[model samples]
Target: MKGLVYKGNNTVKLQEEPMPKVEAPTDAVIRMTKTTICGSDLHIQRGHVPTVPVGRILGHEGVGVIEEVGPSVKSFKKGDKVLITAISSCAACGYCRRGMNSHCHTGGWMLGNTLGGTQAEYVKVAHADSSLYALPAGVDEGALVMLSDIFPTGLECGVICSKVQPGSTVVIVGAGPVGLAALITSQLYSPSQIIVIDMDENRLSVARDLGAHHTINNASGVAEAAAAVLKLTDGIGCDSVIEAVGVPASFELCQKIIAPGGMLANVGVHGASASLHLEDLWHHNIGITMGLVDTVTVPMLLKLVAAKRLDPSKLITHRFKFADMEKAYATFGDAAKHKALKVLIEYD
Candidate 1:
């Protein structure tokens, strides 16, 4: 088997590796069929995620077939097609019971971080029953791959956490994949306005096509962007502000454009500390929420896809064979240059 291995100091290499087997009572070995690179993978490569040691396989989103399942795995068996979740949960842990599977004591984001991931011919999945979803017949595998991470992250962290409601005004800071996911899902609540801000005009254009009522290019700077947002909102600011870019400036922009009593949801995976302007926000009665994706909504999302209410496949902008894993990473890494959103990597 061949897998993409992360080498420290901003490097990754595709190398031949031994096949994975079921190693625990609750484990299952998946023969990957389709997978995609995530922004988090780029973060890991850039040395932002220190816990990810060298030699770790670099992926957490994909669809695969169950090659083998341990004795304790009952919900799935050999030959079942499944969607691999980015976060793993025991479903018996305290955090899991609270629906915070991303913090599950025994399993939370182990794949592509602390454990081998799905960017290979075969990858081991822990807590198999809780971490994998059986694929519905005839669904697009490329779209299912989006379900494994970005879509859920956007729905849970950006839309749900921010409390987007009907007739409310919303602004998403970042037009990246996760931001676009948030843009697409936020419409489910029929927010009166959906404004997306990004430095890239190409991404902003895509946001418009995906239903953003307004788009702003933040290239001029935060003040100008905020002014533009304020103008769009009639100087009232947005009812809900979602920060989807994992950067200090983007987070700051979210703070600047939130309504007095608005909710600010931080969906970005920040690798560095971002300042919270408590002094300025003291009189504003605003709410702030951020956390890793628990993927508790995968089932509901699947239903939406089945019903044709949501089309995640629109996020896919490129595809590559398993052997072209390196090229996939390159394209995804230079996303702006390639106008790429999501790059799907498939196995034979």
Candidate 2:
């Protein structure tokens, strides 16, 4: 088998690798049908995620058919079409009991991070019963691929954490895939405004088409963007500000735009330290929250996709065959140049 590998020092390579087999009673071996590179993969490739071992298979989002299941796996059988969640969870753990699957005792985000990932023809999934979702009939694979990470991630870590309320002003920093996911899901709360900010005008255009009430291009600088955000909110700032871009500048913009008593929800997987101006925030009574994705909302998201209420396909701006994954990575890694949102890597 061949898998996308992180070769350390800001590099990625496609290499031939041994096939995976069920490693535990709770595991399942999946034949990767469709996968996509994640923003975190870029973090790992750049050595931002230092814990990722060299030569690790690097992907955790995909949809596939179950090739085999361990003895303990009961909810799924061989040949079941499934959505592979990025995070693995032992449903029996204390964290899992609290719906915090991202911190499951035996398995939490092990795929592509601590273990082999879905960037190959076959990869092993731990705690299969809790981590894999059986694809609903007629469900779009491309949409399910989005469900594997960004949707639930954006909803959980962004919208839910921000405490978005009806008629509240919401500003999301970053118009990347997860940012757009938050833009899409934030509509559910009927926020009076959905403002999206980014450096890329193309992405901001996409954000507008996908329902953002306003879009700002900060290519000039943050000072300009902050002024624009304040102007949009009539100098009050936003009620909910979501930081979906992992860079410090974007996170700082999120902090700047949040109103008094507003929530700043961080969905970005930061690789560096960003300052928190606590002195300025303490007097404002603001709230801040961040976390790894738990993906507990996948089932409900599945129903929305099935009902055609949420079209995850809007985020997929490019596609490639599994053989062309290298090129796909290049395209995704340089998303701005390619004007790419999500690049779907699939098997024929």
Candidate 3:
């Protein structure tokens, strides 16, 4: 088998590797059919995620067929098509019972981090029953790839955590995939205004096509962006502010634009410390939330996709073959240059 291996000092290569087999009672080995690059993968390559050691396979989002299953695995078997979840969870754990599967004691986010991931021909999945979703018949596998991470992250962390409500004003401070995912799901609540901010005009245009009521290019600076948002909100801030860009400046913009008593949901994965302006926010009763995506909403999101209420496939801006994994990474890494969003990599 061949897999993309991360080398130290921000490098990766597609190299020959041994195939994975079911190693645990609850494990299953998946033969990947489709996969995609994520912003987090870029973070890992940039040495932002220190826990990811070199020589690790580098991907968490994929759709595949079951090649083998351990004796204890019951929900799926060989030949079943499944969506590999980014976060692996043992449903029996305390955190899992509390619906915080991202922190599941035994298996949280093991794939593509602490364990081998889905970028290869075969990848081992721990907590198989809780970590993989059975594919519905006739659904687009490439689109289902989005459910493996971004959609659930956007819905759970960005939309739900921020408490987007009907008729409320919402602002998402990034036009990246996750930010667009948040923009897509936030509409389920019928927010009166869905404003998306990003420095990239191409992404902002894409956001508009995907239902963002307004788009702001932050190239002029955060103050100008905040002033524009305030003008849109009639001098008030948004009822919910989602910080989808995992950077200090983006987070600061979220702080400046959140309405008093509103929620600020930080959906981006931050590799560095970001300051929280407590002195400035002391009078604003705002709630701030951030965490890894639990993916508990995969089932509901599947139903929504089946109903045609959501179309994550629209986020797919580029495609590649398994042989083009390195090229795919290059395209996704310089996303602004490529005008890319989600870059899907299909297996031969």
TM-score of each: 0.98, 0.97, 0.98
lDDT of 1 by residue, 55-128 (tens): 99989999999999999999999999999999999999999999999999999999999999889889999999
Residue 318 of model 1: what lDDT?
98
lDDT of 2 by residue, 1-348 (tens): 999999998888888999999978999999999999998898898888878999899999999999999999999999899999999999998999999999998988898999999888899999999999999999779889999899998899999899999999999998899999999999988999999999888999999999998999998888899999999999989999999988899888887889999999999877789999887788988999999889999999999999999999999999899988888888998999999999999888
Steric collisions counted per model: 0, 0, 0
With a 3 Å backbone cut-off (N, CA, C), the pairs that clash in candidate 1 are: none
Cα lDDT computed for each candidate against the true fold = 0.94, 0.92, 0.92
Ranking by lDDT: 1, 3, 2
RMSD in Å for all candidates = 0.9, 1.1, 0.9
Residue 143 Cα positional deviation in candidate 1, in Å, after optimal superposition: 0.6
Q: Tens digits of per-residue lDDT for model 3 on 147-226?
A: 99999999999999999999999999999999999999999999999999999999999999998989999999989999
- For candidate 3, list the clashing residue pairs, or say none: none
The global Cα lDDT (0 to 1) of model 1 is 0.94
TM-score of 1: 0.98
Pick the winner on lDDT between candidates 1 and 2. 1
